[model samples]
Target: MIIVYHNPRCRKSRETLDLVQQSGETFEIIEYLKTPLDTSGLKALLNKLKMEPAALVRTGEALWKEKYRGKDLTDGQILAAMEAHPILMERPVVVKGDRAILGRPPEKVLELL
Candidate 1:
């Protein structure tokens, strides 16, 4: 099954959702902001994305800049931070089977479909 970690307030996330809907393929939407992922879940998502935990973070977010920027954090620490503050996570992460992509350009989500 396909799944997308979405934030309705984010334009890119909304666009990604629209693209998924337009594809006519059924997918689960995870409103990550309201229901933040746990550390294990974030780790699993990183594994699915085939990326380091840092790669999945929105480093520009004020929370990240204020609390985590330039900090020597391990992968586990970063994942923990994201679990504690979902806003630090990047948007529109689309997952299908064992693969996932960070839908930054929104078009990147097509790779999974």
Candidate 2:
């Protein structure tokens, strides 16, 4: 089963979800903004993403620039920031079995399928 961490307000996230639906594959959607991930959950997702915490952050977000910019923080601290502010988390992370991808271009999800 494929699982997509989605944010409906995000265009890329919506596009990724649309692509998954068009693929005609059964999948699960996690509306992460409404149901925020805790630190452990976020950490597990990072492991699935095969990336560090910073990699899963939307560094361009204003919250990131104002609050976290130039701050030397530990992995745990960064994860905590994402948990507290869901907007800091990158959108449309799709996972299939042990493999996952950040659907930045939306088409990247095709790799997992």
Candidate 3:
């Protein structure tokens, strides 16, 4: 099954979800903000995404800027920040089988479908 880490507040995430629905493919939505991921879950997602903890971060968020900007963080620290602040996690990550993609333009999710 396809899994979409979605955020209703994000326009791109909504668009991605709409596309997934239109494709007539099976998918599950995980609202990361509402159902936050722990470090281990985040690690699993990172493995699927083939990304480092820093790569999964929404660096432009206020939380990152106000607290983590310019800090020399290890992977563990970065993951800790994301675990503590789900808002720092990027939206609309689509996972299928062993692969995952960030649905930035929304259409990227089509690759998994």
Alpha-carbon error at 76 in model 1, in Å? 1.1
TM-score of 3: 0.97
lDDT of 1 at 68: 95
* Clash list (residue pairs), candidate 2: none
In model 3, where do residues sit more than 4 Å from their true spots?
A: none
What are the per-residue Cα lDDT tens digits for candidate 2 across 31-109? Answer: 9989989999898888888999999999999999999999999999999999999989999899989888999999999
State TM-scores per candidate: 0.97, 0.96, 0.97
Error of 3 at 22 (Å): 1.0
20-93 per-residue lDDT for model 3 (tens digits): 89989888999999999999999999999899999999999998999999999999999999999999998889
The regions of model 1 sitting more than 4 angstroms off are none
Q: Could you tell me how far off, in angstroms, the CA of residue 84 lies in candidate 2 after the best superposition? A: 0.9
Candidate 1 per-residue C-alpha lDDT over 1-113 given as tens digits, one digit per residue, 9 for 90 to 100: 78999999999999999989899998999999998999999989989988999999999999999999998999989999999999999998999989999999999998877
Ranking 1 against 3 by lDDT, winner: 3
- What lDDT is obtained when candidate 1 is compared to the true structure? 0.92
TM-score sort, best first: 3, 1, 2
